[model samples]
Target: MPTLPHRLLHRLRLPALLLTAALSLPTAAAPATPAQRLADIATRAYDDQARFDPLSATGVGDHRFDDQLPLSHAPAERARRFAAWRGYLKELAGVPVAALSPADRLTRELLVRSLQDRLALAPFPEHLLPLEHMSAVPVQLAVWASGQGEQPLRTVAQHEAFLKRLAGLPAWCAQAQANLREGMRRGVVQSEPVVRALLPLLADLAQPDLARNPLAAAARALDTPPAGLPVADAARLAAAYRTEVAERSVPALQALHALLQGEYLAAAARRPGVGWGSLPQGAAWYRQLVRDQTTTALTPAQVHQLGLREVARIQAEITRVAPQLGFTGDPLRDGGLLAWTRTDPRFRPFKTEAEVLDAYRAIDARVTPQLPRLFGKRPTRPLDIRAEPEFTRATASDHYGLSEDDGRPAGVFWAVIPDPTAYSVVGMGALFLHEGQPGHHFHTALQLEMPLPEFRRRTWINAYGEGWALYAETLGHELGLYTDPVVYVGQLRAEISRAGRLVVDTGLHAQGWSRERAMAYWRDVTGAGAAQAANQIDRYLAWPGQALGYKVGALKIQELRRRAEQQLGAKFNLAAFHDQVLGEGSLPLAVLERRIDAWIATQRR
Candidate 1:
């Protein structure tokens, strides 16, 4: 629970020192220049980013900032942050890129450009609709209260800290109302279906049964009774749900529901696209987001086109294996492939969640020996598998979790197992490869172990991180993990899933496609059933451009690897190439390519 500045500076110190040292070393050639100074400033800029978003720090295993949260809602606070960003940009403009090392230069350019882009978005009324279907005040409260995710519920002090957090629910709901009101005035409202989803979620929170309520469950777990405190303390910690839900949260929901019903829903744009194009300056904002997220200057049209090409390539691969899985007739016609996979008995009945986890664990065991063949370095932290929590599992995907403060908990691959019958063994092996072993678990854990700056460790560029995982899916053959054709199909299906995302995500937001249209696209393209298709579309709607990052990133990484292999020919070392890709920490794809090209040149020597 450190202050924002403290948390931000703490994570930056190590990297700053290392970077300074690197720059000061007598080059035996010449003195440093303005560009080098700018690179140094950009590193500081990244430090500022780490501070502004502490949750991001936790994900990167920098626990120094775990207690702080951004208050982006306050106008004064927003102004202060904006001023700071403007100062950083001004400093960046003074230095040139040519004087810095390639790595530092890229960091400087990206940091400045991203900051400018973000400032451009500052005028938009995003704060009004900050809490949406993807994330909201209530959902975050549930996550923090559950004591299972990022918020540690371990010690007495930690427990009390949570109680204090819970006490602020009523005020948070009020803030949400104010924000939503602002959004309404500005015409930046959510779609009807998203607003409709909130009613049931809020009603569940407002339930009278304390046992079933997540807040009450946490309060009851405390060693001391929270009910017998001072009037003010007791009132604060006690169930504000009754008053908040009835007065604020529920009414806000109703207001939002009405807005959607009366205004936004009827006028809701039908294109099932994922971008800011629907709002004022949306096209420019989306272009900037594409640049920021991918860490490359690729346009939306370029990304959209890349998605098409990758989808075709992967579909051809899928066709190669579909027949071997005992499928007859065309795989893409008449729902044949979907029917076959969904009804296949080999894919059903796990009997228990443990069985599902064990299946992933077993894949972890099998994939260990192949690691040294493809990766010279491996993660010290172990990997585990578990079931995702039930409440959010409906919209959640299988995800990877980083280690705890002490690193004892180990990284985990959590499979969302709402019903065992829905589990498809056809894809489990590939899923394990991507989310569990040799994929996210290995990539993320090892990155945490690097000696990079704290800011670099905690920072994320979705394209490189997720793209590497998708590229890892392609490594199953190289790593000897896809011996089974069914599992091979699983890997293909996983790729298909990413490729399918490009079609549906853009279709929904950019193309004016309806929810049904998007869902049908996923079903037709990937052969995922109605339920799976619906969940995926809902996920995209909640998270807009996020889904596009996976396939987009994966394709870039795959492309880079192919380019390196083609150039290196017989001298190309797979293990060395992977080591180089990861050694630089999570970098923008452009930076990553430069690093790899350097490696390729050294090999040519």
Candidate 2:
């Protein structure tokens, strides 16, 4: 670790000493006013977060800890995070909420919820079951190393900073292996199939060939050191980085792969038996996950039933589009139309990848003008559609990568078009709405643009972010783009998919449904293909109750809009309501509801 810089050592030492003394005293005894105390508390919380997960810190534009990657699953570090959460809650308890402005109270509420959630989820074996096919530490480190992500690889210092992180990978992997073994002992393990799926991916990550090994991609980034760096230093840094990856990182990942494929794979649950409830205390754990994920008090059963009702409701809506699509059958009752749309020739309009890419751009252009009607605040940042990077496009799913605040690599929505002819036109509009404009791009960019507190800005509420995206899909109707029958049904299918997650996620975990049973229910409700259903089911298995948030959050936002519209009547401005919902950046659903209710009352005047 680098020593404290000589010039600021004394200055930093004084504040560190002062902070130590002040933290020991009663928080109420602090000299700052309540508002100042809250601000300090928020700042402290964010700093603690940055320190604990430095990669995330770098991802969010805080470079102070860019050089480090915490072995968070390690015992001492885990305990420290737990202690920090408890400590934050205790400090927050001292804040006099009544004395603060409504805004600060909301801040307090969000912070409290966020901290409490950490504590609530701390007891779960999520840390034990860390590695997944989608993402974990390995994928993250690879993404950062590729130089396409948030961490800068341009300057000599930046390159060295990442080198430090690369050096830490082996230790983190060792700890991760221990945790996985512990999970196997405690009956907290991933499915055999998921593990099997992940084995090859990890192998690819640890491959001997630099072209195939994702982690080694970091070395290529080091090939271009900042221009001013001395040639000797640059070459040295590049060699050190490649050596670190080849010597330390790849071997560590290989060890993990060997462990998982050998013993962990043997110990893993079979497909039908993979539900969380099969584990000890898993029922209650699933409930806690529900509470944590949805940010509401709804039980797993309630979510399941809500999913059922929504499936029926959306199925009814799907029937109305039958005439336009020429779909024949009682799809409204049993979803024949959904299956029909998939096979319908008209839906497969794209013959080339270029056509599919241009269609998305065209949709963005068409929807650009109508945005003013429903949103008072739109993102000032430019968002464009692009194919995923050539390296990962074949495997990566459709996703939106937020632009750096500096704007060197512009924000882009990456469309994963493995086969253009296979891309369905029916879902394109709603997909664009969710992943591109007025969804993630809008939600994320607006937060960066706003002058919110750093902690709040970076502290993404998954429910809010995803729910807002789901909610954003519906805005297509008001934006005048869903006039196409195919697009309208596409929107409904997307909603059904989210709704199906509610049932299937809760069913698999809480209702004791088998993987096959979950997939069956999912298809019956959403009319999704078998592959799609299996993929979605596996995802929920990887992260319980996480999928629950999409629909739950969107429902809450829609409910708040209804509440606001009912209260304000003809005076209600959708743009204003949307602004209120998004103006504070991402929020827990309950905190978001409070903000909306307050907005409703204020508008009553």
**Backbone N/Cα/C clashes per model:** 14, 1
Summarize candidate 1's per-residue lDDT along 251-292 as a digit string, tens digits: 544554455445444433442333346655566655665665
Question: lDDT per residue, candidate 2, 99-201, as tens digits?
Answer: 8998788788878877777777667656677677655667667766667666777667777888887788898789889999898888778877568667766
Candidate 2 residues lying further than 4 Å off, grouped into runs, are 1-29, 221-237, 270-272, 330-335, 351-354, 389-397, 405-410
Which candidate leads in TM-score? 2
Q: Which residue runs does candidate 1 get wrong by more than 4 Å? A: 1-51, 64-70, 94-110, 220-276, 403-409
C-alpha lDDT values of all predictions:
0.62, 0.75
lDDT of 1: 0.62
State TM-scores per candidate.
0.83, 0.90
Tell me each candidate's RMSD, in Å, in order.
Answer: 7.0, 6.3
210 in model 1: Cα distance from truth in Å?
Answer: 2.4
RMSD of 1: 7.0
